[model samples]
Target: MSATDLTSAAEGHGTGSSVGTTDLIDVEATDFMPDDSVAGAAADLPAADVAVRAQQLTKRYGNLLAVNQLDLVVPRGSVFGLIGPNGAGKSTTFAMMASLLRPTSGRIIVMGADPSKKPRTVRRRMGYMPDNLGVYDNLRVDEYIEFFAASYGIHRSEWTALVDGLLELVDLSVKRSAMVNSLSRGMKQRLSLARALVHDPELLILDEPASGLDPRARVELRELLKTLNGMGKTIVISSHILAELEEMCTDIAIMEAGKLLAAGPPREILERLGGARTVKVRFATGISETFTVADDAEQAALLRRLLVDEGRDVVEFVEHSGGLEQLFMTITEGVVQ
Candidate 1:
């Protein structure tokens, strides 16, 4: 690909019998700070501080624990991701963060407000696009967006313009007159996203926003998400599709069986999962297991130090972060659920 060409991917699947988890590593608080380029100016940077933070978040149902001491932090103007198989507590986590489910334990701060005690404030600041988006089937697209605008106490005069703008933002302006029920599955998903944006919320909690969409529709929605990020919207999304999330998120968290397995910038996660990068070896004729090293860095490095002979002359010594999928596989042998 060209330098200008960029790609990302999601990292999850529906729950299966056994839960799969990626590797986990501790990140210094410094990891969350904006670098020099990001700290330059408002026109050039997104929000300056943390938009969401979780400390030892936990939740339970009867005797079964739904969420473990999970920790997460999301910065403004970034697309953060959560991935895992079904029953991994991914949806439950989003709900608790959105104030829909009160966690049994742990602390959650969304946009600087505690959802536990001040759900209204948190909800007002957030636009949640849950998996089940029950839009008023009778209302036209424009009317649907307007209805939400009204509920938010927007003035009638401002409603039309805001609705128009939101429609355009979600790329559904052309469908303004169509009945909400008339839109295709993808269109409805986009419309729901539009509804979420109607209030011009600061934070967006999107649970499977791309679920059930055709390829074309999924691409369009991804593009819209990219635009939202460029416009400085802090978004948190959950998806079983690891490829999609990898494409859009700057940072991500991998969950399994109610616990966070890995969380950090993509490269950091990949490194901790087992690879520093990638290493390839070449031999004149062929070398057997002589060159093979364990995935663990310390063990591999120690072997290399002792086993490598100057006579053999290592043909290849390459180092690079492995692909997300490869890293994920190296860390866990089973399905993510």
Candidate 2:
């Protein structure tokens, strides 16, 4: 049960660079422009580290409540996961945060500006990739990216260099001249992501980004997101696939039937929901022991006592953990309103 042995034993774990703008890019501050609306609202951001906050956020459709009295806060420079079963109001909440839908009652503050009040400011600061992304089949990859960069009001002088850099970031540089329709599902998904980043927004609201991707594609997407996060972008992602989120997210929020069931780091939510995790200890003699613990500290302390106090020859000490899936099930009733 030595530290090195424990490190080798606990192997049940699951899963950064900057690009400089070259002189060939040759862009002044004015060369890289945002929309007029964005420019006007950019100066009005309140000084705050809270990237997004929802106060009693609710949305109703006639007699049906899509989201009910939900409160959420997302900090800057974090990869956040928003998860729920079908009809759990995740999409509704995302819509409100993205300024695509108005709330029935409540407020959404994104990047220190209320999206409803100053949507322009939020738009300039946030990049949203919906679950169902549309692609212009006729447009080439570079053309598609250029279209969005221009829509964000990037000046003509910077479009070529900007689009090129974004394509490289998404691993689509070689496909730049390829037609959008000619690409596979995975390639198209990556292209959509490149489109989202064209604006150089600080926050990315991504819905089901890995929906139909193959295993390799999903891994690639996850790595790309991590790179973006390393470069200081706060990303809010939603997906039905719990395991994927469990691996990539820094924090998560769960919802059921339009109500937030839990929100926080995965471990905190798991503990709050009374989720129990087990520790598996194997001795050199082929004997094993299992102990259930409420938290990591407890598990660590137990291991120490077993090794030091009892002088046990521990060969393996694996944390048979309860992850995000366990916490999601523990907190949600699976009822769809």
Candidate 3:
């Protein structure tokens, strides 16, 4: 039940196999034809400025409105993180952008193509790694990567080198011959990432990628993602790990109850949302004071008044900006839908 099964079935590589509901929910199936109308409209956008744009996107499951009029834009070549609590519809939003699910209302443009109308075009340019690894059973690590490579229509001769490069990229070259089921959770997560990159996509959509990794594995994943972003790939990631996201993401969107609470560069959002910066000052006279400022200008004015105007013997001055965890706690009311 690997993600390759969904790719193979969707891309016409499999015969008439049936995919389970759980598999369908977690994996991306991309084999639909393109629509010229949607393609032409998407082409009107400035491709360099945006990678993914959603205009009032909505999704409903019968009586449940999973995603509600969520509007978002991910700039190209940026690491965008989606933050939300459980039942926040982040996964639903990702599924729509990946072309695995159609929106109940509104429009979504991914890589300048409408995923609902031009799924093939969108899917070919994007790679998706879900939270669950699915079932790998007896497949070897190399075999698993090769399976996805073939599913993406890569030549059989090129698979050896491709698999080698991907395994090395995920630091799993030594486990190339080991059974996928025998690997630990972290190793399987890395393997799944390799599977997603088999086609060398321009965009990567990762959901809870660091869900079960150890601290070392999480650090490795963060560095690897930064490397990929440096290589000009736009990454959209969703995680409850706010600290990691704060360190790695260039832009972030916070969602709650299927609604966007904030979206932009972290600093800009912090400034706009009235996030305060704490300044600590120590004097040579064994006296210390702490002040909270709203922005850099205020922080600078305070420093100037103390050192120049007051003529005080300031020994140390340090400023601390609020972190993403604080922002999340401040903005979200713990509401789950």
Candidate 2 off by > 4 Å: 1-47
> How far out, in Å, is residue 290 in model 2?
1.5
Candidate 3, residue 99: Cα displacement in angstroms equals: 0.7
Candidate 1 residue-wise lDDT, 1-337, digit = tens: 0101111111111111111111111122223322222112211222235566666788999977878877777766668888776777889889988899998987776776678888887777788999886889998888888888888887788776676666666667689899999989998998888778767676788999988888899998888787666555778998867778887898777777787777766655765565444345555546523333334574467336644744454555544344566655665445433
For model 1, what is the C-alpha lDDT against the true structure? Answer: 0.68
Tell me the tens digit of each residue's lDDT in model 2 across 1-337: 1222212212312121222212212112112222212112222222354566776789999999999987776756778899999999988998898989999987777776677877887898789998896899999998998888889898777777776677767787789899999998999998998888877777899989999999999998998888777766789999988888888887788888887767766656666664678989999999998988878789889999999999999999998766777777777788988
For residues 1-337, what per-residue lDDT tens digits would candidate 3 score against the true structure?
A: 2334324422334343221122211112221212312122322334345677777789999988899887787767779999999999999999999999999998887876789988888888799997776747689999988888888998898887777777776778899999998998888988888888888777899999999789998998887787666656789999889989988998888898988888888877777774787999999999999999989899999999999999999999998766888889899999998
lDDT of each: 0.68, 0.75, 0.79
Where does candidate 3 clash, by residue pair?
none
> In model 2, how many backbone clashes occur?
0
Report clash pairs, candidate 2: none
Better candidate number, 1 or 3, judged by lDDT: 3
Error of 1 at 262 (Å): 1.2
TM-score-superior candidate, 2 or 3:
3
Candidate 3 lDDT score relative to the true structure = 0.79
Largest lDDT belongs to which candidate? Answer: 3
